[model samples]
Structures are given as C-alpha cells and as structure tokens.
Target: MIFPLTVDRVFADRTRAEIGRSVLTVPAPDGTHVVLGGHDSTGPEDGYPIGVYATPAGEGRAPGLADDLPAVGWLRTARPLRAAAFHPVLPLLVLGTGSYDGGYFFEGALVLLDLASGRRRDLFADDCLREVRSLQWLDAHTLRLLLAPHDDWEDRAARSEGHLVDLTRSDWRAVPARSLRPEDLCGPRVPALLPQPTPPFATPDPESPRPGHIRSLTELPDGDILLTADHALLERWSAAGDRRWSLPADPRLSGGPLAAVAADGASAWVEARGDWRRESGTFIRIALTDGTERERHTTPGPAGLLVSSGIPLLVPVPAGYGELSRSLFRHGRHAVFRDTPRAACTCDCPWDDDEECACACACPLCAGDSMDDEEVWLTVVEADPAADPTRLAFPGTERRRQICPWSWEPGETHYDGPGVWIGETDLVMATVRYDGAVRVPKQGFVTRRPIGEDPSGTPRWVFPVDRTATALDIDPSTDTVLVALSDGELIALDATTGTLRARGHVHVHGVPVIPTALTVTGPGRLLLGTSDGRVLTCRPGPG
Candidate 1:
C-alpha cells in the first residue's frame, strides 16, 4: 500500500514524536474511512486509544482525521497499539502495545481486529508481554512478534523475546506455543552488568533505560530473523527465538540504532544511524552463521543498505540532511567490487622523501588522495576457500580508493551520491555539487580497476554520465546497467561500451515516479520503490 507521504518524512521535524502514535489513515472499501490508531507515547492518562474509527464517506478520508465530527464515527479500543501488522491471508489487523506506567514503563499487548467490521478481539493482553516492537506475518495464521520488556524492568528481566501467535487457535493458551528468549536461542551469554554505586549514601536513582526497543525486524531467506535492538545490536534470532548470531560494535566504527535491516540469501545488511555532525555512518554486513559471534564489513555513508536478489546495495544520504535526506545507490556490487581501497603510502611528502614514504599507508586504489585530503576508503574481504575452516580473508588484492577531492571545504561543498557496479568490472557513481543556492550535477564516473587492485596509480577508465544517476543495477544475466534518473526515467546502458541499451519511464498505478530504491529482480524484471512508499515491479523490454 502506498501513502501520500512516508511516516518518517511526515514527522521528520518532530524527533520526539512517537512513531507509534502517528495515526495512519487507510482507505476502506466502499469509499468510507477507518482510523488506525498508532502507539501512544503520551502517558496512559492521556488516553491514546488504540482502535478503529469507522466514519461515513463524506466525513473524511478512510483513515479519517481525529478532529472530524462528534457523531461521525465510533471508537473501538484494543490496546494502546504500538504496532499494527496485517495478516497475510485474513483481513485482520494485529495491534501491538507495551505495558506503561505513568512515565512510559509499560507492558504491551497484541490484539487482532477484523478490519472490515471493526470487530476487535484481544489476542494476547498478558502482563508478561513486553513492548511489541515489530510483528511479521510468517504465514496465513502464524505471526512472529518481537517483544521487549518494560523500561523500568531490571536487566535480568529485559530479555528479548519472540512469540509465534496462531490466530486460528480457540484457547489463548493454545495460541502461544512457547516464549523464545535470546539466551535460550543462542549459546554464548551476553554480558550482564550490575548497577554501579552512585555515591556515599545517595538516594537510589532510577535505572538507566535500554536503547530504544528493536528499531526494525526483518526475515532472512533461511528463516533466521534479524533483530536490530535499541542499543545498535544486530542479533539474528531463529524462528524459535534462539539467538543465532550477534554483531558487536567496533570502536573505530561509528554506530547508532539500526535504521533498517535487509538481507539477501548470502549476507545481511544493516543501516546504522550516526551523529549528524559526523556526516557519515557505517553500513555493516555479516554472514549468516549458527553462532552468537559475527564479523563486520564497513561501508561509506551517510548511507543505508538494502538487499535485492541476493545483491547488497548501499543507498547514500547526502550530507547536511542527516536522516531526512533520501538518495538511491545503484550499481552497489560494482561499488563494492571496484572502488574498494588498496594499500597506499601516507607520508607527509611522498615526492619530497621517497624513501620515507616507502612505508605502506592508506591510499586510494583507483584514485590516489594526497595526505591532506579527507578520504573515505572501501575495503572488501572475500572468503578464502583454501583456508582452514573456510575463514574470510582480506586478499589485499581487490581494493579500490575513490577520491572526493572537494571534501576539505569548510561548508557542505563535497559532492556525494550512490555508487553502482556496472557490468563485471566498472564502478559507476554519481555526485552532486551545491553552489550556494542551486544544487547541480557535478559528475558521475565508472571505475576501471577490478575488485582487488592497487589504487596508487591512475584508474583504468573514467566514463561520466551527464545526468545524476541516483539508482543503478546490472541485469542478472546481461551486462546492461539499469540507471534510474532523478527525473523518473529508467535507462539501461551497456557497461562494456558505455552505450544506451534501453530506456523507460517509471509510473505507479498511473502517476510519474521518482524511485527511492531500485533492484533488478531478474534479466528484465525491475523493482522500484518510490518516495511515497509504493513498490512497483515491472519488466522492461530490451532495446
């Protein structure tokens, strides 16, 4: 379903605004309206009711406005809904909420509602259920819900849990097969800390809260669930609520709560939010494994990661906008393979003292940056098949460095855009320059070096695409590069010869489209995500 505006974008200005409290107006059949109440961040005394509002057609939109008329609709309360999940088969809306005391510490609930008639039924309202952060429909009647205990709860009580609720069950006892916890699922135990003493005979202070609840949950192809917690921890949970793997934060790597999680068959990708002043963040990847330990792969940002058709892509958010900016990274595989950094010399004067500069330092693989340049490097590590236990190895062979020659400026003058992989060998990237008032296209180039290469020398090829190519992807079988322009046109280019192969305009339902995300499903199938949150899948004919 597509909305006129995204939830994030609509409430962009309100950071403290409860994402769950934002009411979503979904149009009902027969041109009537139903108000899907969001989670209430305000205290329970505030009476943020979780219910469905049925309003007459002329009263307002299907997701009717709360301020319409007095007698326009009836309020049906389930539990102050924290999240709503639609059953894959039945026309039911699953509502989630947590317990809340006067000051936000509250256990949540999961309620099932018939969307058509507003008939509500409390599926589970136990005090044992914590905040229902996320819910996914596993099948027709089976639903997976991510739960975290109330805020004021002790660390020992704050275990992450997942419950499989069977909607078809008659008895509530039969609905929940078992409660799955992190410790029960994974082998290694996460470190637990006792509350530190405050001062000499000081009054007992309140407990520090855990990071925000799971920011998002995604299902992997292998049935492993990816849970991104409030504290920037990305844990892999089994369908049975066992923790399969978890990624620890590296000090050198900036971290934040995971904004989103996406996985292809091979690896899972996480988009981590960072400080706005930093102007960058980490896009981490971890292999799907059976242990609680995991490895990390770093990428450039301000960026986000998405997996489509088993290929991982990085979507870069332009500088200055922080989380609000949206731009698509096309040709991500090429960026990973081609623009990775190789060994370099980092002496103050490489030319002045050649012998002193002989020591290996950070240098650009495809393009060399001087010692003074603020550079970002991409390092790609591949699995070594010949190694014992099949461990990942940095071959030192496939590395490329890209030089953003303009990052040294005081204000926001550096150009940033998503990089794409074209064909098998080229890295395509688009960058924009803001000249005070107007933002103009700076340049888009394709890298020439292979995945593993030294970047201290000149690049092999640098072809520029005139218009800003926000999204790019190569076809599954062909060497054609699919480019999504800011103007809503999808163009296919021959990566080998830099020739245009095909072109098509994007449309959703019937409106012109601006794609926020693009993925090549197959040789000709393309999936496009728009700014309005509508996903369009289409097949483009060859030129």
Candidate 2:
C-alpha cells in the first residue's frame, strides 16, 4: 500500500493604510499591555503627523481605534513625522520630522514620546532636516539615529550634516566629526542597479538606496568591535571610536558587496557576490595581516561557500538543470560512476594486454561492444599533483582510465555530498538518494577505496541512521562524521567502525531550529546558523 501526504494553506487579511509608517510593537509600562508607535506621515507634502496605538493587556492583536482601552493613548506632533524608533528597555519612542517646500526645507525637529502619559517632548532640531535613515537604541537612555541633510532650499542655505542625538542629555553632535566627508560615506562605483529582465521572482522596484549601508557588525572576543560594509571593506574600531585599519576589496575579481562573513580567528572568511556571467563572481580568502588575497572560481549559481579549517566547500543550489547535469559538481572536483562492460572478448588480443584496445578491436573495454554510446563514455578525473598539468588538459587523453567494473545495474539516484579523506590512500564519498516520483527515506552510502586504484574495486555503503542527510562534516581527530539532516537533527557517525556515536536536537530559545549553514569550528565545536539569524555553538558530549 502507498500513502500520500499533502500540505495545508493558510492566509490572513491585513488592512492597508497610507498614514501609518512601518511601526514596531513594543511592551508597555504595565508589562502586560503593548504600545504601538503613532503613524509618521511627514514628507514633502504636509508636516509630519504622529499617532499612537495600543493593545489590551495580555492580548496579542492591536486594539481598534473605537475600542475602549485604558492602556492606550495618542499624541499629536508639531511637524510631519520623519522616522521613529522604540527603546529597547524603556517605554519611550524617538521621532523625527520636518517641513520643506520645493526642495527648500523650513523647520526640522526630533521629538521623544512617552507612551504612559501621551506627552510629547522636543529633543533636537536644525535648519537642514532631510530625513532620518535609521534609529537604534544603544542602551537604556542612549539612542542612535542617522539623519540626512534636507534637500530643500531653506536647508540648502545652511550646511548639510549628519547628526547623532543623545536623548538622556538632550544634546546633538555631528557624526564622524569634520574629518570624514559625506561623499566618503557614499557607495563606490557600482554596476547599473537594473533588475534582471525576467527575475525568478517578482519585478524589482527602486527603493531609496542607503549610501553607507552597514552589513555585518559583531563584537569581538575582546572589547573591540569589527564592522564590514557591502563593498567588502572591513574596519576594526576601538570602543573609544578609534579607527584601526581598513582593508580594500580585491581589484582583480572586482569583488562587489559581500554576501556573508564568518570569522574563525584573526582571519575573516568573506564571500562576495559578483556578476558570474561577466567573470565577476569569485571567492577570495583574505588574510587580515597585510591584506593578502587568494581567489578561486566556484560552481555557477552558488548559494554560499563555507570554509572549515581552511578547506573551502561550495554549496550550489540546483536551478534549471536536469538531474544528471545537476549532480555534476555537487560533491567536489572528482565524481564516481558505476560502469558496466558490454561484452567479453574470446580471443586474447595483443591490444587487450595493456588494458588498451585498438579502434576496431570491438572489445567491451574498447569503444564498440557497449549497449549505449552515452553510457560507455563514463570517465572520472582524479586530481594528481605529480601528474603533468599540460597532459591533463586534453578532454579525455590522460585520465581515460576506468576504476570499477560494470557488474550490477546503476542506482536511479546518485550520492553527492562532502568528500572525506579517510587516510593517505583511502577517499570515502557520501551519497544520498533523491527521487522525484516516489518518496524514499534518505540514507547515506559510503564508497571507499585506495587512491589511484583501478575501476574494478567495489565500494561499500554505510548507513548511520534512518534520517535523511543533507550535509556531512568529518572530525579529523576522532574520525567521527557529523551529518545534518532535513528534519533539523544532527547525528554523529563513527567512520572507522561504522557506528552511531552520538545524536542531538538543535534548538534556539527552546524552539526547534533548522540550520541554514553549519561548519565545524574545531574537533568538538560545531557552529550552527539558523534561518532566524541565530547562531549556536555546540560541543560534543562525553562518550
């Protein structure tokens, strides 16, 4: 008997309004109720407007305007609201607003709103209020807001500047002082920002671009902080606002905005995205010492690339390619195939002695006695440092040797994942089963043998558990294998004896998590990154 499974569809209706800006829900003073920011409708048209909304105690949804709620209050603003941000721990909201006519700015002001009393207090104001880019709460009383100079006439009369305001002392200060110019903050020369003509998703829309968009900023092990931009510019800054050093992007690869950044030690692993068709998308390894660079061309349409102990692994998503073509480079440079001979030779010809047959020999090992011409051409290329690189350049000349004999029929699905170098001679490959017609439980089969061996050798399969595996990482110290599954579970397999060593469920904040990226930090520490932007460090337990 066969069983079929189906998924459910659910949808919710959301009201559309032009008055309300993007508002974030926050906890109120009572701790049970929630306070919503007032809508900010400030722009070139009318002055910025502000309104507040609230939710009932213990309720999840926001209360309607007609509902009677004692915990809710609204405050009027003097000018149109430009931008607003909620405090991390306090019931305070910071708002910015201004007025402009024909690109000429008039009055610009920053206000602080107290949710408990519905009272509005002025924070700061200037003649050149352009717009607020971002607002973040640094501490209980300290707030960081990014302000752009107004692009209006009245504001043009005054000097344009970016200011940082301190709500605790009610004071404003210029950002980066007078040393750095605004043009320096602007983005470098970039390719045309035109969207793909037929993007895989929806049509692209032009949004106001932030010139100096900060990418990843993480606190180091020490008190210092590391910051990176979209253009692969890494900067280390001291806690006291001191610039240490700035590393430039690689000019050869035309390294554009970075896609991801991971740090192991003093070195940082940066994956920058470039135009592949234009010979731009290349992965580079940068040494923080003197900004030395090494680059490698990876698989096309690579989703991400990870480095484990200096070994780079390319993760490419299958897109628009057939099944056979999709498995081309899933594992690595070397791919194994199970081949069979077409017929047996009766006569002991001289050509068959050296494992080579003439063009008209018609032996199964030669060109003619095969069932299918396409299947007869299966050849595997093994990387040999000692082999002449020039001889290996020909399509099928130097590496036209077979390793395994074709005895049994090939499996419908191919196994492709991490390549494990078990010892100096043995190289084991992990394979998984994937079928589009029927749902089959995923399993791992190991193909192990000595390097540079003939195709006559057989490979053995090793199954750790019943779960479907997505990725495999081998521990060099213990020879234990870490397998990441589709169900968000990680299992450890002992490669030497083919036994299950350990298993554990990965979670973040008590909720089950699916790891989007996984890397072995050390022999025992495994770094897991989830789709929800959470990272967890897991160490192996005692046997």
Instruction: Give each model a TM-score.
Output: 0.36, 0.37
| Model 1 score (lDDT) | 0.42
lDDT of 1 by residue, 1-543 (tens): 112212111111111122223444333444443434533422211234433444554655433223332222223232454466655545566666554455535455666666556555554433354556556666665566655544544444444433323233332223442343333222222222221212211121143122232333345556555545333346565544455665644443333322233222445555555555233345555555642324454434344444322344443433333432332334343223213122322233333322333435543321344433334343332323344222222233433234332222244332445455544444544444345543234344433334344343234444455455555666757776666665455666666665666566653322344454455655665555443223444564322
lDDT per residue, candidate 2, 400-434, as tens digits? Answer: 34544322125444434444556544555555554
Provide the RMSD of all predictions against the true structure, rounded to 1 decimal. 20.4, 21.9
The clash numbers for all candidates, in the given order, read 29, 21
What overall lDDT, based on C-alpha atoms, would model 2 receive against the true structure? 0.41
